[model samples]
Target chain A: MPNPTAAILIIGDEILTGRTREGNAHYLAGELVKVGIDLRQIRVISDDHATIVAAVRELSASHDQLFTSGGIGPTHDDITADAVAEAFDARLDVRDDARAILAAHYAARGVDFTPARLRMARIPEGATLIDNPVSGAPGFSIGNCHVMAGVPNIFQAMVTGLLPRLTGGQPLMSRDWMVMVPEASIADQLRALAETHPEVSFGSYPFVQEGHYGTNLVARSTDAAALEAGFAALQTAFPEGK
Target chain B: MPNPTAAILIIGDEILTGRTREGNAHYLAGELVKVGIDLRQIRVISDDHATIVAAVRELSASHDQLFTSGGIGPTHDDITADAVAEAFDARLDVRDDARAILAAHYAARGVDFTPARLRMARIPEGATLIDNPVSGAPGFSIGNCHVMAGVPNIFQAMVTGLLPRLTGGQPLMSRDWMVMVPEASIADQLRALAETHPEVSFGSYPFVQEGHYGTNLVARSTDAAALEAGFAALQTAFPEGK
Candidate 1:
């Protein structure tokens, strides 16, 4: 059976403006790969309602699972929840359960539960909350979409809470062989070898390190035996590491 | 006039599988912003031909400029040039000029111009070559789309060669103010202040550092005076920083 495919939608202007570099997509991609979910695409868009709504609807329909990060805060630009609700045509309001969670957490810190703070409690109808162990504001999962916080720490915590519940296929395994040869010199051999091992996916990444051109040939497959065979064949083909 | 819009399409399976963390999108975003080009969106897709072709066609039509990175090598998995040619409905083949460039470069190093090496000479009809100072393989530009190498150094060199030739608007100016206060506590104030400075764009990024909650308010505008005024207003409103 094919692995379940997923798409990530990153909503933020900071990323587009080049203010913030690291995001939840990288971490989520690694985690999803380990859990046997194929991450097919990742889109980084601005904090706009129409764009977010369109992306969410489109990605959710195409992929088995959809993950989103950013725009779920208390500020005016945090419109992810509302956009997601609009995408699913679901009613959005402050739920007692989400509100209670936030209220208690804030109360423990002696912070006021202002109306703005209450915005975090607003969730789409028929959605389950994804726990945020680091922060009180909870993320939500609606339909096949898992919405998480933008902050790296909170996003990681929510993903930890959410990934295990979903069904997964066999984890993908990868092996790499580094060769000190130009990719052009080995392209034909690599192609022939890849055709011989049809089950393994081959990727050739060329690099220039210390003024020396080289290529890192990576082989990935869910079957351990196939991966090992492909790796062994690659090693034999370039015995001197070139 | 509004800034010219641009979109980036990153073609690689390594990114989707989280095998590689850094890519060309971040570097391109910062460069585009510096040149007054509004980066509207960035999409990272696998090295599938149909997917890359569709993305190229869509992004090329939607934005004023489209930049693509990856899959433009001699390896079997490198199909970007062919896919881009299909997207533009242009015939792709080894052109004499491109072949001459590669032949001369390889001859200097005493390397054979193998058929695999010759694959790098394929160029879409009616496209102009973008020089790669770091490597001999030349990138191409068809219409508003700029196809570049996946390697960071080569990609940077190609971008440097291309960006200066395009028309650019005024560079965007930005100012940031960090306050040690909960975003919820300052959401209303932030909204009001944002409204007062209608010319600038405000973005609130909340963080938790050393058990303290804070928000970084970033104000961006093409007009330097307006950005400074907005930043000053935010500082006055949150003098205590909490």
Candidate 2:
């Protein structure tokens, strides 16, 4: 069976402008891998509504699931919720459930839940809200698209709560070996081995650590036997401590 | 003036698998900022030729310039050169100048330059080579798109070499003030300031450092005076030292 696939849409000016370093993509990719879903693509766009809307539609149509991070804050650039609504052709409104949750969360901290704070309660019509365990602002899911906050802490908590509910496919497996041989000298042999293992995925990453010419060969497959066989062949090509 | 914009296409499977944490986007963003070009969007796609071609076309059409990193290695997964050629309706050929450079580079290192190494010398027709001061395999540019190696060191060197040759607009300037205020509580006041300064782009980023409800207000503009004035107003809104 084919692995379930998902794409990440990181919508924020901060990420694209190099003002913020994104850790959410790595977190989401790791979590999705654990749930047997392959992260097919990751697109980081500015907070422009058109770009967000276009990316949402494109990724949602291509992948089994889509997760977006950023641009849902109560500021001028916080237009992701509206963009998602427009992309799905749905209406946006302040959700009562989300409001109550945010109100209770704010009340617990002795902060008044103002109208601007209610912006976080807004969700696309007919979408299911994913509760944020770290912050009161809830993430929502419309069809296969999951929209979450850009804050790493809040996004991670929301993902942990949402991942268990997803229907996963075959788990991804991999094996890796480091070699001292130059990449070009062994490219033809590696390509032939790659063709031989049709069920497996092979990657050769060149590295120059401490002024040494080496490459890391990794093979991934769902079939354990085929994966091991491919690894064995690759190991024979380059012996250790050479 | 509108911010000078550029987009990035990260072509690699290593990124999707969470095996590699990318530093290229950050490096390019910083480099572009020095050249007064705003890095507006960055998308990471698997080393699929069709996907690369499609993304290159889409992004190049929308943005001022498109920069691609990775998938130009001497391995089977390195299909970036072929994909870029296909994207621009050009043919891939081993350029004589590129071959000479690579051959000389390898000869200097006392390494035999094999045919597989010749794969690195291939360039899309009607493209200008982007020099790799550190590595021998040069990156090249076709139209508004520049393609570079995925390795951080090599990619950085290539982009640095390419930046000076490109024309850029005014540099975008920014100033930030750390405010000990919740986004909801200060949203109205910040909104007023933003409205007053139409030329500057203002952003409020909430943070919880040490369980404190605070936000960082960043004012950005192409006009240095407007940016500084906006920062001053934002700082006045928040008292010094809590």
Candidate 3:
């Protein structure tokens, strides 16, 4: 079978307009990789229903799992829940389980649970609630997609709560070798090696120091032996790694 | 007329893996906004042809302009040029202009112009070259889509060189008003205002201070007068500005 793959949907105008830098995608990428799920794509869209609906439909069909961050807040622009529910043709209403969680959370904080705060309790039909410990707003899992909060702290907490429940594929293993050789000089050889190792993924990152530019070669694969073989070949080719 | 909008495609695994914090997207978003182009979407994809091609095709069709950062270097994993060429159905070949620029750059730096370095000269057919002052690998513009170097320094320089050439739309104007009121209490009022000003985009950013959470309300639009009017009304609703 092919490798398990995942995608992320970031919904917020704050991110698109550069008002806020997003941390959820990067955090989720590493988290998914640890569980052997390759993060295939991440799309950041404004909190528009058409955009969110289109992205949700496309990503749901392509990846094994889809995690969405943002737009599940209590404001009017937080229409991701409604849009996602519409995308799946699922009815949306306040869930008893989610309401209980939010109510309890508000009580603990000595805050009144206003009607507007109930917006967080509204979830799609037939969706599993992803509990949030950091805040009262609960995330939900519908089909292949998991909808979470836009707040980085809340989103991270939701991911931690959700990761253990899902089934994962093989864990990805990786190794890196830093070479002092200029990237251009080793382009042909690296290309050849990349073609030879079809199962492995190799990447080169160039860094400049004291007016000299060199590259660090990273090879990753689920197979430990193949990863080692790829790393060894890379090291042998660029022995001066000095 | 609606404001001209642009989308960004960030191509690199380093970014998704959290190995490299992205500076290019943030810079590009600000530059696009300053030039009166609304940044609509941003998608970060790995060095995969199918993903890059699909994202480029979708974003290119939806927005007035599309920009791609990273994967234009002279390394093996730098497949963005080929993918973009294929996406546009344009042939990729060593352009004489790009070749001349890279050749002259290498000569000036006293670095050997190897065949692998010639890979940097490859450009999509009918593309305009975007000059790179930091490094020799030149960025290119194919139709409305601008492909630039991924390195922060080089990408910034290329954007400065390219932005002057494009015709801009009505500059998007904005006004920020901080509210001490909780988002929940203002949800109803904000929703009513949002419905009234259908053309303007309003977003709420919540922040925590001394264990108290409040929100900053930002109203944005291409119409300066409308934005100011909306800001005035919004501030009146929440007179106690925090």
Instruction: Point to the candidate with the largest TM-score.
Output: 1
The TM-score that candidate 2 achieves is 0.96
How far is B4's C-alpha from truth in model 2 (Å)?
3.9
Which digits, one per residue and each the tens of the lDDT, describe model 2 over residues A1-242?
68888999998777766788788998887777667898889988888999789889989999999999988888767999999999999999998899999999999988888878998899999999998887788999998999998888988898988888788887767888888877787899889999998888899888788888788888887788999999888888777722
Better of 1 and 2 by lDDT: 1
Q: RMSD, model 3, all Cα superposed?
A: 2.0
Worst ten in a row by lDDT for model 1 chain B: B233-242
The local lDDT score (0 to 100) that residue B124 gets in candidate 2 is 90
Compute the DockQ of candidate 3: 0.66
Q: For residues B112-178, what per-residue lDDT tens digits would candidate 3 score against the true structure? A: 9988889889999999999998877899999888999887788899999999998788876778888
lDDT string, candidate 3, A107-195, tens digits: 99888898889988999999999988876778999999999987777789999999998888877777777877778888888988888
Docking class of 3: medium
Interface RMSD against the true structure, candidate 3 = 1.7
**Residue A40 displacement in candidate 1 (angstroms):** 0.6
Clashing pairs in 1: none
lDDT, candidate 2, B1-242, per-residue tens: 56567999998888888888888997787667656788878888898989899999988998889999998889888999999999999989999999999989999999888888899999998999999877699999999999999988889889888988888988877787887877777888878898999988888788888998788878888788988888888778776512
Q: How large a fraction of the reference contact set does each model reproduce?
A: 0.80, 0.61, 0.66
Alpha carbon deviation, residue A187, candidate 1 (Å): 1.0
In order, the interface RMSDs are 1.1, 1.5, 1.7
Give model 1's DockQ, 2 decimals: 0.80
Structural similarity to truth (TM-score) of each candidate: 0.97, 0.96, 0.94
